[model samples]
Target: MKNTLPIALSNRHVHLSEEHIKILFGEGHELNKTKDLSQPGQYACEEKIDVVGPKNTLKGVRVLGPARKNTQIEVSLADGFTLGVVPPVRDSGDLAGSPGAKLVGPKGEVQITEGIIAAARHIHMHTADAEDFGVNDKDRVKVRVGGERGLIFENVLVRVHPEYALEMHVDVDEGNAAGVKNGDMVELIK
Candidate 1:
């Protein structure tokens, strides 16, 4: 029998506050505050662009806010395709390269120099699902993403909470590198 699991592509991002944005990018840089439609307490800011990984030069991307301390830049798989890099969700301090502008507004001309960031990889599961999966909060496990681009993702942290839905979150870079698309299957390989 084939091993198959349901996977959902995370195109959503949690925002950081204005205060944290300044610390990463530097003072005087502006960050636009916006509400996250899905989750409360989550806000996005239009600030600096973060170029992750080894390749230098600006990749065509627009970083959104709220600015976070360790976790920042919420890159989509589509954006990763443009940059041609796999951005693992990680702390802001871990990101390489100088800060760049994230254009906002209608014409896509507004610029914020705060900087782009990558959040840490995590899985959110409801209480019942957590029990079914036989996992606990902060438990580390591996995820097997199957399809044309198959990969075994290791070191994925599990976050069990009543408010959360079952899903795995990865940054734009990682999604692109793995060639993951919407409605893909990601099985727990614990």
Candidate 2:
């Protein structure tokens, strides 16, 4: 049986470590929530920063919080080209031997050693939804999106957690190519 899941298009953004947050913002600055994201306990902060790459700089890049163990930058392939960095497609929090960039905050700037990545397209499903979809955590599957720009995306990672809401996350390039928008339903083909 095939299952359909809602899609969420993720833009280029950074998740900062607490130390980096203090350095970039201030000694005791907390990320002010701009809005709650689909994921549990995650949000877009009011703060924005500029990320400088080898060939270009990306301005107004939103910061997503609460803080991560290590800082990581997620971008699409098109975004990678714009920044002149060939980012590896990695799952979130998997930043061993990735690329790096300079992050410019309003108060300070810091150089990240290695964290930039093209986040892998994945589906976050709670236990109940996982059971419904007949999948488990870390299972790889294919997804079919129907439209004028319809396509079948392979190796879509399945992330299962009780706290995670059911949503498929893809970068801007993937979404645009598939003609998908937020709230669009995509089918999971085993």
**How does each model score on lDDT?**
0.56, 0.94
True-vs-predicted CA distance for residue 93, candidate 2, Å: 0.9
The superposed Cα distance between candidate 2 and the true structure at residue 160, in angstroms, equals: 0.2
Model 2 gets an lDDT of 0.94
**Model 2 quality (TM-score):** 0.98
Candidate 1 off by > 4 Å: 1-14, 18-71, 74-116
TM-score of each: 0.54, 0.98
Q: What's the C-alpha lDDT at position 65 in model 1?
A: 51
Residue 38, candidate 1: Cα error in Å is 5.4
lDDT tens digits by residue: candidate 1, 37-137: 23334444554443433344343334455445543445554444444445445543555652333432222232334334445667777788888888889
lDDT of 2 by residue, 77-108 (tens): 88889888999999999999988999999889
**Roughly what TM-score does model 1 have, to 2 decimal places?**
0.54
